[model samples]
Each structure stands twice: as C-alpha cells, then as structure tokens.
Target: MRPKEIQEKLNIDGDRIKLFKREGIFTPENPPSGNRSTNYTDADCEHLRLLVVLTKSGLTCSDIRKLQEGECTLEEAIKIRKNNIDAEIKRKQNALILLSELLADKVEFETFETDHYWNVIAAREAEGEEFINTEDMYGYRAVSLIRSIKCPYCGEEHEVDLEDYMYDESSYEKENGMGPDVVYSFNSEDGYECHECGRIIQIEGWIREYPEGAYDSEDINVVEGEKD
Candidate 1:
C-alpha cells in the first residue's frame, strides 16, 4: 500500500511516519514508502497497527521497538494499551463525577483515599440508575454494605461487611505479590473476629472479583483451636 493508505490505517500523517522511520519504528527494508504500489507488506501493516496503539497509549516508538527485541509479546502490548485506556477513561469519569458534585455546591471534594473507593464507585454506578439520574450522569454508583453475618461461635448475627474485609485482603495480596489477578478466591487464612463472641470466623470458598464485588461464599467456620 501507499504511504497515504498506510497513514490512514495508522491514523497518522506523513511527517509522523517520517519521524517513526527516523526513530527506527519502521525498518529500512519494509519502509512505508511514499509512491511505491506494494511498499508495506501485510506483516508491516499489522506491526504499524500495533505501534499506533502503543504510541497512542503513551509508549514511545523507541520503547515499542525495544519491546520487539525482548520477551514482550504483541498480545501483551495490546493488553497494556487497553488497560491504559481503561485507567484514563476511569480517571476522567471520576473527574466528571467530582465536577458534578462541585456544580451541586457540595461542601467538599473528597480526596482520593483508596483505589477501593473507585472500585466501589464503579460498582455503585453500575448497580444504581438512581444516582446516575440524580447526578445526570452517564454513570455513578454506591452500595450500602451495612451487611451482617452470623457468628460461627456465638450463633448470633452481627453487622459485618465480609465483602469489605475481603476487598482489603485482596488489595493487600495485590500489593504484596499477586500479579494480574482476574479472580481471587478466599482461603482459610482470610478471616475476621466476631463482634459478639470475639472469636475468629474464617470464611472459605468464595470467588472475589472486581467491578461487581460479589462473593460466592461456600462456608463459614471457626479456627481449629477456637472451635475445639
């Protein structure tokens, strides 16, 4: 294809392509030539497509060309670009919501406390049409997690948002060592102290995931020594 056609595919102009060529984003052999009929091959076009996405998502052409020599795969680059896009979109959405609050003469703009708040906000926005309507938003969410649970030791029900606890636990895991977790289930170590009995209640068998922080709980039990 011609340079104009390739530029149309890449959403870039001739000068930008020239810059890329200068920076070695385009190889010497497979250059996006100006007047050549069969200049860019299928493989070249595909690579240019990937490079366009990478550059749009804030990667330098040099960085992308370096990635080609390393263990980084094309799929990983695409995924990274998608994640960067999502993060930027979410950041803008939060800004819009905050701007709405300012328009309503709200007393204070809430400082960003945790990413958990954003996750919950996403959940709330997805769950509630009411807030969206009130805020006149494309979206916004809030879930009342005033949840209660029965104590395994005391057989008494008490207010305890297990979901909130698990959120913190998962966040800790993410910070510590866990990598790119799509879904994480609770284990025996994930537990909480009972409000009534002061005994630990260990929750097991649950898939905890984001956007919709719903838990599929299997069982609630006391610790080994505590129960015995």
Candidate 2:
C-alpha cells in the first residue's frame, strides 16, 4: 500500500504515518526509490493496526515506544490502566458521598416547612475517607425510612403511613403534662411477606434521626432484608 492507500484504508493521517516514521515507531516496508515515495507491505499494515489499538486504549505514543522496546509488557500496561480507572471511580464516588452529606447537613441545621422536605440518603461516609461506605448503605432514603422497608429478595418495597406510625415524643409528653426532652427513636422487629415475590422480608433494627448529638448505639441495623 502507498502512503495515501494506507491513510484511506486504515483511516490514519499521512502526517501521523510520517511522524511514526520519524519516531522510528513505524516505517514503510519499501524505502523510497528513484521516483517512488514510500511503500507498505501487508505485514506493515498489520503492525499499524496494532498501533491503532495501542494508541486508542489510553496509551500514549511514548508508552507505545516503551512497549515496543520491551520496557513494559502489554499485560503490565493494561494493569496500570485498570488501576487508573479504579482510582477515578473512587474519586467520583467520594465526591458524591460528600455532596450528599453536605445537603443533609443543610437540612438538619435549617428550618423547613412541613411540605418543603427534600430527599437525602441515610448512608455514612467511610472512616478517614470522603466516599460513602457502600456496604452499610440502605435502599430507602432517611425520610422514606420512617415508613418503608425494602425487600432483599426481588427488590420489592412496602411503605406504611406516617400518620399510622410516627408521633412527636416531645409533644406527646407535653400533652400528658410531663416535662421531657425530645427523642426521635424508632425500632421494630418485623417480618412481612412481600406480595410481589411471596417471600418473607425481615427488618429487625433501629434508626434515630436527632440532629443534636451522637447515639450510644448504632443508628441503623438491618438484620436481613430477606428471610428464609
């Protein structure tokens, strides 16, 4: 193949081929003759195809040279690429976790109308890390947690009415003419059959949502969503 033919067939630019030649990364099988420019063989074209793959998969031209010269094996380069991708995923996940916490903080400190509530996750961030700890994350948001329990089997979900479940402890104490501080603790040992999958879903734990301070016990403890 001629230079133009290689460009047309491989979709590689002519200047790129020339650059590869100058860098000694690739060269024409046939050197220039009296009147001819450059020529490529079938074998040369196959090598160029491999170069295309190497360049596209996050490998720089310098990296390719190192690869060709046996400075690093292809498998080693791929491992490096995989590590970079994993790091990027961690960074993005950390950012998401931080953002969710910040939004929830705003909700906690500021006053909101009865109908002005927004959504927020109930998950906590990792220790000394900015990312949310995905292992302890729950399926439902904090607001929804007051009434909803998710199934572990088929991802079916059930929710009760807040009017049927929740009551302000401080207000209840005041109605009974007793002086008491506020507390927002919810606990239940429940096992309900899911209508969708006909499987028993067990949720036996407690979660408190008091913005004042820390709790002596865990905030949320999910025993197991699906029961046998």
Candidate 3:
C-alpha cells in the first residue's frame, strides 16, 4: 500500500507516519522508482500497527527501535503496560471505596482524615482537583439514600411514604394539673404492604421519626433504636 492508502486503512495521520519514517521506526519496504514515492508492504503495515500500539502504551521511539532490533520481546512490553493499567484500576477502586464510606455516613467528611494520595486518587488535576470538597458529602448522600430506598416486597427502588402504613404504635401520656405529656412509640413489627407489589414488609426495627425533646432512654431502648 502507498502512504496515503496506509494512512486511510490504518486510520493514522500523515504527521504520525512521517514521524515514524523519520525515526526509522516503520519504513516502506519498496524502493523508490524514477518518479514514484516509496511503498509499504503488508509486513511493514503489520509492524506499523504494532508501533502504534506500543506508542499509545507510553513506549518511546527508542523503545520501538529496540523491539524491532530484537532487543526486547512484545510480551515483556505488554507485561509492563499491564502492571501500570492494573495499578491505575486499583487506585480508582480505592477512590470509589472512600466515596462510598462518605455516602453511607460511615465517615464524616469534615473530620475524615486522608493523605495526599487519597486526594490524588479521588480527583485528577484536569478535573479541577483543588476545588473538590467533601464537607457536605454526607448530607448529599443522606438525601439520595432516602430517595433510593428499595421496597422489600416488590424489589422496586423508589420513594414511598410509610406514615400511613406504619403501625404497632403506642403512646404514654401523663395528665398533670398544668398540662399533659406524651411519649409516642412505633415498632416495625407492624409490617406495611407494598403498594407496588402487594407484599407485606416486616421492617423489624427502623426508626421513622421522633418528636423533639420527647425521647428518653426507655423509649429508645424499648424500640432498639438506641443502645447505652
């Protein structure tokens, strides 16, 4: 194939082909005629393809020359590239784990301790790493979690109101001369039927909500919502 044909077939630009030629990395096998340009053979095209792969894998011109001269094998170069790619994958996984902890309220963003490596893993300089902050990460996760709760019965991941369905409610009241005081209690043993699937979900013990200043150790302990 001619240079233009090789460029079209291989999807390589003329500048790259020129650079490869100048570096003696992938030369055309055909000798020049009276007025014809140099031509590349099938074998030359195959080597050019390998050169492209090596260059994209961060190998330099000299490295390709070494490989062409039989100084190093393809498997060795691939092993080195594989190791680098594997390390990059591990770094990304660590960042995701850290983000998950913050989202699950396991770590308070403000008090979360991290080293420089963590920051590097979490954000890249090209993505505006300096402006990244985790202060409100927990709050954002809380809201998103509340919205994404899955219905046990139907396995439908959606938001549903349990106010009307919640049962096994009890209230303790004290009527004094001044006024009245009450402590309300709710247990998850009273299951709710899924509106989507019509299956009853026994939540066991999940706190819905509580009135401010109305909770004590007895009330919380009874429902297993708190431990002392």
Q: What are the TM-scores, per candidate, against the unseen true structure?
A: 0.32, 0.37, 0.34
Task: Tell me the tens digit of each residue's lDDT in model 3 across 1-228.
Answer: 786898898898866766676467866678333224458899988988988888888776777787889988978766776775666565566567657766776666677657744665546645733322333132111111012345654566544222222344443444443222322233334334445765544433233222322233322211211224
Off by over 4 Å in 1: 5-11, 28-50, 53-63, 106-228
Model 1: per-residue Cα lDDT over 139-206, one tens digit each = 22222233555666678776543333333334233554432233433333434565566666665434
Number of the top-ranking candidate, with TM-score as the measure: 2
For each of the candidates, the C-alpha root-mean-square deviation to the true structure, in angstroms, is 23.0, 28.0, 28.4
Best by lDDT: 2
| Predicted candidate 2 versus true structure: per-residue lDDT over 1-228, tens digit per residue | 887898899998865665465456886678544224468899989988888787777665676788889999988888887786676578568667656766866755456432432222223232443343443253212222335656677776666222122223231234453333234443333434566776654444433433322222324443444435
Evaluated at residue 13, the lDDT of candidate 1 is 76
The alpha-carbon deviation from the true structure for residue 115 of candidate 3, after best TM-score superposition, in angstroms, is 12
Local distance difference test scores for all models: 0.53, 0.55, 0.52
**Candidate 1: TM-score?**
0.32
TM-score of 2: 0.37
Q: TM-score ranking from best to worst?
A: 2, 3, 1
Which 10 successive residues of model 2 have the least lDDT summed? 162-171
Runs of candidate 3 exceeding 4 Å displacement: 30-37, 53-62, 89-228
lDDT, model 3, position 186: 35
Model 1 residue 76 distance off true place after TM-score fit, in angstroms: 3.8
